[model samples]
Target: MDFTQAVEIAKHIYWIGMYLENDPFQCHPYFIENGDESILIDPGSMLEFEAVVRKVNTISSMKNIKYIILHHQDPDLAAAVPEMEKLIDRSDLLVITHSRMVPLVKHYLIRSDYYEIDKHGHQLVSGDLHLQFVTTPYCHSPGAFVTYEPFTKTLFSGDIFGGIEESWEFFAGKDYFEKAKPFHAEYMPSRDIFNYALTKIEKLELEMIAPQHGSIIQKEKIAGLIEKMKALECGLYIEKEYKDRLIHTIEELKEKDLALRASMQEIKEKEELLFQKAKMADMGEMIANIAHQWRQPLALNNTLISILKEKNQQEALRSTELAEKLQEMENNIQYMSKTIDDFMHFFHPKKEKNLFLISEVVRHTLEITDPMLKKAGVSLTFEISSEEAVEGYMNEYMQVVISILHNAKDTLLHRKTKDPDISLRLYENGKDVVLDIGDNAGGVQQENIHRIFDPYFTTKHKSLGTGLGLYISKMIIEKNMDGTLSISNTQDGALFRITLPRQSKTGKTDATQPDH
Candidate 1:
């Protein structure tokens, strides 16, 4: 429970989050020491980056951080990713997350390629390290998920079981569920969605629940906590609107006095009936999605079994080949049979395309980059000359902006510019929107300008730049958004311009864009 250093809660799991006294919402970032293939889960916000990094370094080197598991897109759990990736200094380190989270999480301008759990069969195997992911969409966010380590029987439950406690501890006591209920009531969408996530957790051979916030739940308290969460009145049922209305109605009935008791009884019965009907409808929809998600995996497992039987009958089955096939089939069957109930919810309505203001994207991007700029004593100026709307991937566009700003920041700092400055201007050009970002650092050399967008080309020290930033930025702007990314040198510095059509021509809804 000590927050002074990394606490090994399990054999290989370490609690590496920062401790802020009396803070209701404390973030917990965990580190798993799997030798060289160690993993960091929910690396936390920029505020805790230094503390988290120091704690991680105490037990293991940053270079050994092979995978960063992002539970969702919230800044409290993800904003430090860009900075952490730079410090980890491993080119092969990957950000493991759900495919539905790729769009938003990518806006942090992460350099490493993503190992999307949904696309990669919901499990990862590297060296002797094995991780299974569980989808728990809408337990908070649409792409919300959790990581389960079978060896330790520990579930990294993200915000699903997280609490807001004024007095915090590393491990949950019996009163943990009461502390966690308020968070679920405020953040979760409905009790049914929460119960769906609980059902998934119940299926796992869970010994502990290491969530992104609050205390970690031990095995002895796990079952009781799950049941309490299942029957808890949270989300829509206990939201301010519903609670206030119910209270007001009861108060009016009490004022009337004549049929107060009868009316109260009738209202309670009607409310229960309505809630049951709604819960049933929600459950049916969940069942349908589960069936849809299981179909492909089930079919594939069946095909593998058929192939195995035919090979055995023909007497052509090599022992090694048969063993591999059986293992593969077993994995498939396990996935299909015990799949996360809301796995298909990644395709929920939240992922659909919608119009977004260009100004808002710039604002959100600055909210992250501005702090870094100030810390480095670099001045930043921005202008929103137009209120243009772009019907493309807003988060992806934000990534493009962040990537450019990050490069500029590095360049200015590396050169030791006396009065470093970055300027941003967004305006409408014909039917397209144009964004111009310029920096006061010396302009790119003529020879390097042509090759700037080339992959693996860098004018930076080996550790400072991967040369992938400009390359991927071009790909995201040109290929994904049907836009153009071009650069020109002003009298004082280099200026990067991004031009995009106001409306999306491809109508692409896929959040998982190609990394290249």
Candidate 2:
């Protein structure tokens, strides 16, 4: 088909209205030649329609238009129908629309033979041309239809595919995609419905889409446009490509992961060191307890020895009696050595699972922390409610208690209250054993309360804290032992509650603390 042909038909049609110039609403009214007839699609505004009619009349004197198709009942397109009806004497078919749109079309332009297409996939024939009407409702208007010319492979898509712009070029150029994006965003806000319409039209093998408003879309860009419409149907935004941006995001994520891993390793090392330090501290406390235990015996032994020395000096002691005193002194020294040996064994790092008393763990923890509590001037209290043994990893449970008590002691020290106190309460609530540690220091800061257990988040002076104490304790109790650790603010200070399943339910206990 020649580009400047007045009337040509092979498998294509030509537009014969004013060039759109740049306005999407303003389109050149043109005629698409079929065989002996011409289909005038959206015959522009009334004035543009008259200009087209005059040009057609001047060219061939074929003023007898067979059919006037209206895709939508808009006045801009259908306004010229009434004017054309007066000019043509032949029985021109008025293919208005379905019954729903008849009244709307009648309100604007009257006096015509109206044919109603009210079904999906309806066809209308004129000589050698086949026009198929596909219902495209909810595209700017109800009862909107897009006409497909099968032989020419051209789809006369109305407002559905077109957009509002003021470009007057004949076809969508390289910049068409960019230009159409904003138009669809504004006019076609219902992407869901628009996608449905696109799907319906996808069945047809269309070569050209001459929308009523915008530029005609040619073969090269039609498929690209359809793909874009499909993307819109799936609720996707077309993103700009930036390799550097993607690389930066990946690098940042990698850096964060590396930092997290490093921080976690550091926390693990600190926890191991702390446990070692606690063990040493507990040994020191056990030695003190041993000294307290042997005080009376040692004093009696000293008294007996002094008497034996005086008797020997006075030359009045029997050999057997002297041997007996020596024997008694030897027994006391052996007993003291045995007591020290037992204390050392209790503090030794042993990997074993056994049922143990919760009170013992509490006592052991308090003994280890006694010096620190005294140094901080924080009085300590313990309330163990379960006389019946509740079991768990002895060392881990003790460590958890110690960590909480340590935090409490620090809090009290920081507040510098006159009557600084730390309290440990252990009790069984139903099937679970619970431990509550609280202090008389002011509770955690309101904003920092939730983040206290988060790794590396601390309110203490930076050098004074590693910030992993509570976090590591939580990991040990909750993740390793299937227990729960929570923190809440009390009137006087922050309280930490740990709940561990009792031995009766768990059936086994771990004596050795598990690394988490």
Candidate 3:
């Protein structure tokens, strides 16, 4: 496991990472010794330049290192590129990387010409080695990519699959994802983008994963680790963390609400009270949403604990196995904790406006409501005709969408509608972005249509319905977000439409309104 000198991983592949003991963030640079056609993949920064060169010298001469693969433009993995060029000292020594990375990587002031993978069919044949470049865009970096060696079936994944390990191990163990999760949650942009990258990696005939950071993963653990990474929530897709921040903000808002209540004479104070009440009413729905999110993780935790108990009874579990299961259970418990945190923040009051895609709002809303809809035997479909963004409090926008879907789900379940269906459509119309949510649980009665958005108006039994939902939703769309929420009857169902002014180039919504 010692990485003091170059260690041969696969035939000609060597781990030349300058390992600093007890360092939490480890950068791994690999060397492929293919004689005079040698390649160095992600040589570490200037701090480790001398030591890394010393290790590379032991494997092959600097002049023979013909290619240096700069996976992405990150300084730790790429800053030493110019210095390396001085050492290799060859005019023909090409820098291998994706085309999308060329502009940024060039800022490193690297003089060697790039062997752009995208331009050259993503393949390279050096001596006996056949190398392939796999583009993994937006997996943390827009130009992010990985390298694959056909002969060794080994991947040099830049930042993907990397971890921040407090207790460093040369090879990934069974509890590897536990170390990987925190890093992914902090770095990866979103589950969708990361999963997209993972789909490509899954198709590869991979025998090993050598990341820029953390331990190398062998074939035995590749599938399980990839599966875990796919499920990881990170960056802007960290809804749970977002909600936690919202709740923390809400606690401060609640203190202001108390002051507003004491001065009820002001018209704005009355409006604030109504908004606060509506937010409080949403707490119940948020708790239900949390339950849906927690279902899988809680089930996994139970299964893990049960297996440990059963193994103990049979006296078949080794201490190593016990420790691994414990770590898994801890991870599951942490995930559930985040869900609970999200639930507690269901009533966040809008404080600031920002630009966000309507598509992202719809996606996050479905994440909260899909389980409940499926449990009631309701089928939901969402279609996007445009990717228009709006400037607003995104969380409030998400709340409005969630409220509409909840209302649809409840109505479908209440009326015992056979083969219940809900459809969501998002599109750009003129200067506005429109979202239509329709459900086939029958149309609302004509007499009740106008009164539906009235505060404290409900048709359902006292315990099941809170009249505040639609009222708050209407308020959020019209008053808070400068949009409109309208309801109309379709041939077989009720359709709710939300129309918000599109984000303009000036960081504000367009003043022009959509035709009703």
TM-score for each of the candidates: 0.47, 0.42, 0.47
Off by over 4 Å in 1: 240-516
Write the residue-wise lDDT of candidate 1 on 1-516 in tens digits.
468899998888998988778789999999999777889999999889999999988998888889999989999999999998888889889999988899998898988999999999999997877899999998788989999999898899999889999888778888898899889888988888889988988999988899998889999999988888898888777878986887799898777886877788997786456434433433443455456656777788789889988988999999999889889888877766554522332113143356877777787567545545766678887776677677777765765676688789889999999899898887778989888999989999998899988866889897666666677678767866788999999998899999987754333322111111
User: Candidate 3: deviation at residue 289, Å?
Assistant: 64
Deviating ranges (above 4 Å) for candidate 3: 239-516
lDDT of each: 0.81, 0.69, 0.85
What is the TM-score (0 to 1) of candidate 2? 0.42
**By lDDT, is 2 or 3 better?**
3
Cα lDDT of model 2 by residue, 91-162, tens digit: 654654655677787876567767777752378776777788888876656777788888878888877666
Question: Which stretches of model 2 miss by more than 4 angstroms?
Answer: 1-12, 20-24, 28-30, 34-37, 58-62, 119-121, 232-516
Enumerate residue pairs that collide in model 1.
none
The order of the candidates by TM-score, greatest first, is 3, 1, 2
lDDT at 390, model 3: 91
Cα-based RMSD of the predictions, in order? 36.4, 13.3, 28.5
